[model samples]
Target: MNRVILIGHLARDPEMRYTPNGTAVTTFTLAVNRPKTKEGVEQQPDWINCVVWQKTAENCANFLRKGSKALVEGRIQTRSFDDKEGNKRYVTEVVGENVHFLSPKNQGNLFDEPFSPRPPVNINDDDLPF
Candidate 1:
């Protein structure tokens, strides 16, 4: 029962890499905004690290860019490794199960199309069937 769902924007473009066994892997950071406190204090955004594997990883790397909105569904995992200074470091990341792109294809053109005035119809009130 360990699952997590996050909706956020990409902090940077997804980085794609391959494992020794040639498995495609992609990594990215999601910038999720935190809810304000009861005292109305602004909270800093949470940068969550996410990882995708195989075809999904390839798709994310190919389509996702910085500032692209996405919905990530995954599980949390923690791993430990030794740093350069010989100190053990622990890192947490989400292993993505599904990644949904939320941004429109042409975001910049979203508001570029101005509203147009409609033309008047030639129908008369006397022709109404009601």
Candidate 2:
């Protein structure tokens, strides 16, 4: 199966564009953290290239920004093309079938009220199932 699932923060703002046929496409780089090395040194995050299409592309472009967290479900696709230098280049990227916005609702809002803790709920000891 050519399936891939990634959860990461966007390294930069999503770039949206349209194909000649007017199909929407969005591209972004995801910075996914890698596990520490055996020596316990933190490794640099892996930068993954991702692509989304259609309405999902539009939504990703609208809601996701640099540093926004997201979950992308897709498949790994690799393609080759001739570059301007006349050299063939190969690129591998995730073609997102679904992109879920994982950032807080008011994450990038500047005018939103400061967050306040909710009042603690009072429950009787009898409510415990344990």
Candidate 3:
């Protein structure tokens, strides 16, 4: 299975656009920090390109902004295209299946109220086959 999970901060505000078919698509760059070396020096963050589709794209565009923390779960995809200069350019990006906003509700353009976790369900001991 081709899958990836990334937790990072948005490098900039998400860019939202509509396709000719009116599908919403949003693109953003995630700044993921690299692990520290043995010398304990700080490493430059990896700027990863990510794409979100449909209503999720709209949500991302509306709520996320520069410096917002988020978790992205999706598959990595790579494609190539010819640029205006006639040079072939390759791009690797994560096509987000789910994007969770991790920043505090008070941060950026998030919802007014903080999100609460759902209550856990109670299960009987007999429900287990083992």
Candidate 4:
């Protein structure tokens, strides 16, 4: 079983795209920080690539933005392909099965709206522009 669960901050807004068959897909990099290192210096953030499909992808693209914190559950997959320079490249990505919105900014907003499965009408994709 290949499984992965990550809780991290978005390094950038999710890049949303559609498959040839009109399946929605979104990709984003997460910056995961290590708690503490033996050296006591901050360890470099780990950049994990994650992809979500269908409604999950749409939700991610609609709500997620750079610096947003989220929890993702998925499986790890590594694929090898040739680069433009003809060099073999091994790319590792998480095929996300679940994405949970954990944005801090949304907490205790002026309206005091509670978190919902779907964001409010006012918080639709157009408002986010992510």
lDDT of each: 0.91, 0.91, 0.94, 0.87
Instruction: Give me the candidate number with maximum TM-score.
Output: 3
Q: Residue by residue across 54-130, what tens digits does model 4's lDDT show? A: 99999888888888888999999889999999999999999999988887546421222366365455556767757
Ranking by TM-score: 3, 2, 1, 4
TM-score of 2: 0.80
Worst 10 contiguous positions by lDDT, candidate 4: 104-113
User: Per-residue CA lDDT of candidate 2, range 1-130, in tens?
Assistant: 9999999999999999999999999999999999999999999999999999999999888888999989899999999999999999999999999987887768762233347665789999999997
Tell me which of candidates 1 and 2 scores higher on TM-score. 2
lDDT tens digits by residue: candidate 1, 1-130: 9999999999998999999999999999999999999999989999999999999999998888899889999999999999999999999999999998887766421222245554788998999998
State residue 30's C-alpha deviation in candidate 1, in Å: 0.2
> Which whole-number lDDT from 0 to 100 does residue 57 have in model 1?
99
For candidate 3, give the lDDT of residue 104: 79
Model 1 global lDDT (CA atoms, 0 to 1): 0.91
Estimated TM-score per prediction? 0.78, 0.80, 0.82, 0.76
Query: What does the lDDT read for residue 125 in candidate 3?
Result: 92
Question: Which of the predicted structures, 2 or 3, would earn the higher lDDT when compared with the native?
Answer: 3
Residue-level lDDT for 82 in candidate 1: 100
lDDT, residue 113, model 2:
35
